[model samples]
Target chain A: MKSLIDICDLSREEIDSLLDTANDIIAHPEVYSEKCRGKKLATLFFEPSTRTRLSFEAAMYELGGNVLGFSEAQSSSASKGESVADTARVVSCYADIIAMRHPKEGAPLVASMHASVPIINAGDGGHNHPTQTLADLLTIKREKGGFDGLTLGFCGDLKFGRTVHSLIAAMSRYKDIRVVLISPQELKLPSYVKRDILQKNGIPYTQTTDFESVIDSLDILYMTRVQRERFFSEEEYLRLKDSYILTPEKLRRAKSDLCVMHPLPRVNEISTAIDNDPRACYFKQVLYGKYMRMALILMLLGVN
Target chain B: MNIDSIKDGIVIDHIQSGKCMEIYRLLDLEKLDCQIAIIKNALSQKMGRKDIIKIDAAIELDFDLLGYVAPGVTIDIIRGGVLVEKKTPELPEKIVGVICCKNPRCISTTEQELPQVFRLADRERRIYRCFYCESMSK
Candidate 1:
């Protein structure tokens, strides 16, 4: 009864197994359709994350499962003073599995404690989003063919991207993964991830404000937006905004095979011109996210 | 001065002062259906500042509230009007819906609809983090 609350919750073998299952599903979509014919996926999104919510719904629908639950807390029973425990107890009666996104940090964990079905954290506050981490892993695996010995570069908003934190957690579990953190000092990766995940795993990583100089060395350039609002002042955002943009001119210097990935709804950190480069995998990342989620919905429902 | 003993209860001790209200709001202690004694600014030799809350009918401390208020505070379980056990909440292994993670850019903070999830990664040193945005506050 393992719940995908965090990336590290799944071991390397388990991740590989999930990837393999996703690959099989991708290879033979028709055979896997209707795998969870009667099951229901409850997407209890307390926050309105249209992208993630749609992704989850699409995954469930494609799996031949029904989708239930609310996209916002204000419209749900939770707004009327129902504790997460009560909501979980009630939702479990209707759904085979639950994927919850709450603005609060520990909402999913609390729900998991009381849920009868396996609980998936769609996204919790600024905390971990295991599924996005899952999507990133699948995209990386499909692009690079494996998870070992690649120089993974994390660019922009390293300080607040839960995706970055979760990815570091997942990738740190693999061997010989060198990390290049390209961000302004204001948006540098938190000490916890750098210390707990990277340093503890003994993964070699270097930090710099410059991304171009190191572009050629990276096998993957992960782009995240550093919003001006995240900073104490616009001056700081302005100072660092250009410090990390992935322009086509910049991509010209990157490894010909380097994968350019962004967890989408991207701001201008990435230029549209670079989207045509075969290395730009962000759009494909979205499709893979859906397919991987389709794999997840089937897997968690025990139909895979 | 001798303190009045609770008949059968839990005593929250070493709470950093000025946080009784946060606990009050957290537990809604005012609406409690049980007898309770709350003493703020109580004398202490070890703690320069301390507060105590004694529940007359055995009550479990809302540990998340405790962790958020003061992570290292000790709690005593009392029975027969005597201290039968003393314990401290280990750092919360996972924090959810506790403190508003201080990161404003955090979806949890901005959404007005999500719980602030944090995991207690280092208990002894009192580290908790927002589960979504990954903001750390000690």
Candidate 2:
């Protein structure tokens, strides 16, 4: 079974193919309306997630497949202390594929070990959210036309931002990709990520506390929220939550074609006034996320 | 300070000084009923000081744990007071149930039956990352 537990699990060619399929799905949605006919998708969310669960359900429905499974652990057998392996084995009998989200890291990996069908990791604690990286990739492909020779600026909460880590890992394979990491000292990108992904790949990078000074040089500005769920202390979260706020004034020095993005559910990190600024692609990222999910479902089911 | 040579046993040599206790603890040497000797801060020509452990029984050992805790240490096997074989444990590709992942969000933490697994991520740095969460082993 080919389960996407991490972004690195997919090669550059595979990602390109997924992007191609997503583009095709966007161009002609009717052609793939029956791609997954008679198939079933089980959304096994052990944690509360609105966007990811809905996106998976919506993708399956669009592919003419039936969707089942619980929205949270409280509603599922997990509440009764059922193991993830057992749940996966049981769900594999009903669904052709499984999209799982859990509070614990590597929960989906445990599921994939026992699942007869492919397991898509929607999100696993603060470890990995590969599909979100897929969405970011597709959005970047659509905006910049390719992954090479781009200066990408990642701002805020890089420590716990799984999307940023995964994307950097994915983008490191491309040529001439320069990274500008903008965050406070407290939430800087993890050293392992810098050493393993960036430095090992010979990708030039700059780490800075000043966001605006480097904003003008970036092609893509990925703004992330300071996630409270990732922090152990509320005091620390409060101290770093308002570190970087993307206002219209902040973009004055940035390029007109700069693509500003966020993973969504923004809590004042991105100003509402900048949503109309044509440069803000965060909402579009959500839409692109759905199309990429649809493409992923088709590929995983071998219906594409 | 002379320790008698065992008739049939294993001698672990050249452990970095002061690391024998950790290896002894991790290897659960205290659980064994056989005679065990730990010589700490022994003078060495190669190393300024080293530690050696001698077990008076040819017992099975967890080489992965040994490799992780004390790399480059030599293991000498003896049978009938004659040298049988000498082995050096290499950094294992994967280690299971050797060390628990400290990441609170790792699945191995909540799953009681799950085996704690860590993979060697960097050889030069001797870094082991949790297989479940990829957090660096401290």
Candidate 3:
């Protein structure tokens, strides 16, 4: 593929190859240090995302490449009325690859259309985050051994959580996968997702408002931040935020081998006390984020 | 009373009767310099009631698009006061810049320059999904 706009953009074989490459990068970091020695990466973050922007920059730096671009829209030409198409066209001249995070849902797709180089969607609105899905995949492979025959439980704000949407779509391609969606009424997974991706693929899934009831059957529990920004009022956010928190008491009911996952920059959905727990793989997921990005850059640039 | 036939123009026939106004607005028929006639509730053997549009100008017509809106549409080309070509349009595999995706999270909603494209996902259900965000196009 010319660009990575969505998780489905990569085939099952391609996803497997990317995971293999990530494993290689983790194994022999020294051997691949200078792989992109003279190449450059442009991170055009129209939205403010410190974690995703830094992950892309760090990935490029580890490959012996340079990084450039603005972290926010005010600092870039976007504020001066330059379109994403024009910005992508201009940046493609200066960089070998471009990673973009925009508040608009399809801004990266627009950039990909105009850009000569590869355009990776860092995080676009609440639409899709393919790289985060990659990190989640790598972590799942490491913690659960494989994707087959696993019950994954997703908790908290599934409606606006891009990571949850992306991970579920990616995991649907695997064998014997069952998804348990745990969320409040307002935060339930969008019906289009359940209809298009899950039901259309014939993948079995169950939805519930209670996490305790389904905790023991899950092999992986993905916790998500119940963002204050997603709610209409602060009172509503407060009411739902504490409902899905993954506390030690809640963990008692979960499977012993359950791998607790989360796309970080969390806002109280997961208790900090579980940070030391071996089953909490979110921190390792952060490290894997860099490795997966390294593999993504290498693959996109066609470097060894 | 009969609407005068066009000597050199295009004829869009077999549209579902009540949908003529929608097709007229979509095709921007009001802006055309040629003589145009909207024949509504025309008696037909194939269809009980149909709409026919005849334009006295040879403009480029999107047959696939016409088929998408009204699947049973037929296009006829007239030259030298006689019918030269006849066409029955099929539903297009994908429609570009025709219908906007109503999904708020769709990329096309924000990227004003990008053409709103939809691909036929389920033929039996007549379902179309946006090309960018994969949301159903209403």
Candidate 4:
């Protein structure tokens, strides 16, 4: 069975097909209302996620499928010490497809290994989240028209932001794509990613602490929150927190067509005032997430 | 003093000096009941110094792991005090349960039952990354 354990699990052709399906769903949502009418979706979220879990639930419901499974590990048999493989084996008997979000990296992968049905990784620790990458790709496609020759800038915590890492991994596969990594020195992109994804693919990227100097050259500016929880000291967090904040003043220096994006439940990294800007596509990103997820759910279930 | 040759077993020769213990531990040579000889820092004509391990009972070695740990080591199979086969193992494309991924967020750390699998990410650099999390192993 096909499962999305990582962004690269889907080829470029598959990604485009998913995007095309998303676009079709956007144009005619009612046509897909009864697509998976008798299907069942199991959402096994071991971690507490509001947006991602809800997104999957919403996508499944929109596809005329019912959703089941626990939102937290404590509420499930996982608290009783059921293994992921066992859980997957049991859950596969109940659901047509499974979307799992776990705090442990590769928990979904273990489930995928044993699951009789297709397993979609909702979120797996700081590792890959292929669905979010799908949403990001759809947003990029809609906002920028195409993936080619786009200069993408990623700001804030690149090291811990799974979204940033996944996006970089996805975009590096495209043509003429350059990345500008904007982060404080404390939250720089991991060297392994730079080596494995960017350098290996020969994608040109520039690292900068200053976001304003390079904002104008970017076609897409992906912003990520730098959590205070990752900091050892309040002082260090405060010192570096505002360095990548997207203020109105900062947006003034960015390109007029620059698409500003954030994986939501954002903190102070993106100023609320920028929501009114014509270039702010983050809200649209949330809606695009739903459509893309619907596309993903359909594809995973082999429902066309 | 000369180390005696094995009669019916395997002799691992030309291991880079100081890499024998790691290879031995990885291969779990301690579990073997057969006579084992470890000659460390032995003088070699080709290499200035080398390590050799001679096992006096025929035992199957994980050649993939041997190639990964010390690529150029020579392995000779002995039967009735005659060298039956001589070969150098090549690096395997994938390695399982050898190097543990140290990434704290990696799933193998939590799942415990998952195999610690690694794939050769860069052959030229001899770099392997955790197959699940893609974290590079040093």
Clash pairs of candidate 4?
A105-B107
lDDT of 4 by residue, A171-233 (tens): 988999999999988899999789989998999999999888998999999999876655668
Q: What do the candidate models score in CA lDDT, each in turn?
A: 0.81, 0.93, 0.89, 0.90
> Top DockQ: which candidate number?
2
Q: Tens digits of per-residue lDDT for model 3 on A1-304?
A: 4899998889999899999999999999998899999999999998899999999999999999999999999999989888888999999999999999987777888899899999999988777899999999999998888999999999989998889988999999999999999999989999878987899888899999988899999999999998776566898877877777888998998788999999998877888999998889999999999999999999999997
Better of 2 and 3 by TM-score: 2
Q: Which stretches of candidate 3 lie over 4 Å from their true place?
A: A231-239, B1-11, B28-36, B42-50, B55-60, B71-88, B102-112
Cα TM-score of candidate 3: 0.89
Q: Candidate 4 - CAPRI tier?
A: medium
lDDT of 1 by residue, A1-304 (tens): 6567777778888788888988888898877778878899999999888999999998888778899889998999988878777898999999999999987766677788779998998987777788888889999999999989999999988997878888988888788999999888878898877888888889999999887778999999999987554466788777776666778888888888999998877878899988888999998888888887887776676774
Tens digits of lDDT, candidate 2, B1-138: 899999999999999999999999888899999999999999999999999999999877876668888987999999999989999988888988778899989998887598999999998888999998888887
Each model's fnat?
A: 0.08, 0.75, 0.62, 0.71
Lowest lDDT 10-residue stretch of candidate 3 chain A: A226-235
- Docking class for model 2 is medium
Candidate 3 or 1, higher DockQ:
3
DockQ of 2: 0.73
Query: Between 2 and 4, whose lDDT is larger?
Result: 2
**lDDT per residue (tens digit) for residues A125-190 in model 2:** 999999999999999999889989999999999999999999999999899999999999999999
- Model 4, first chain, TM-score of 0.96
Cα RMSD for predicted model 2: 2.3
RMSD of 4: 2.3
lDDT of 4 by residue, B4-69 (tens): 877899999999999999888988899999889999999999999999999999778776788898
**Candidate 1 docking category?**
incorrect
Determine which window of 10 residues in candidate 1 chain A has minimal summed lDDT.
A225-234
**Candidate 2's fnat?**
0.75
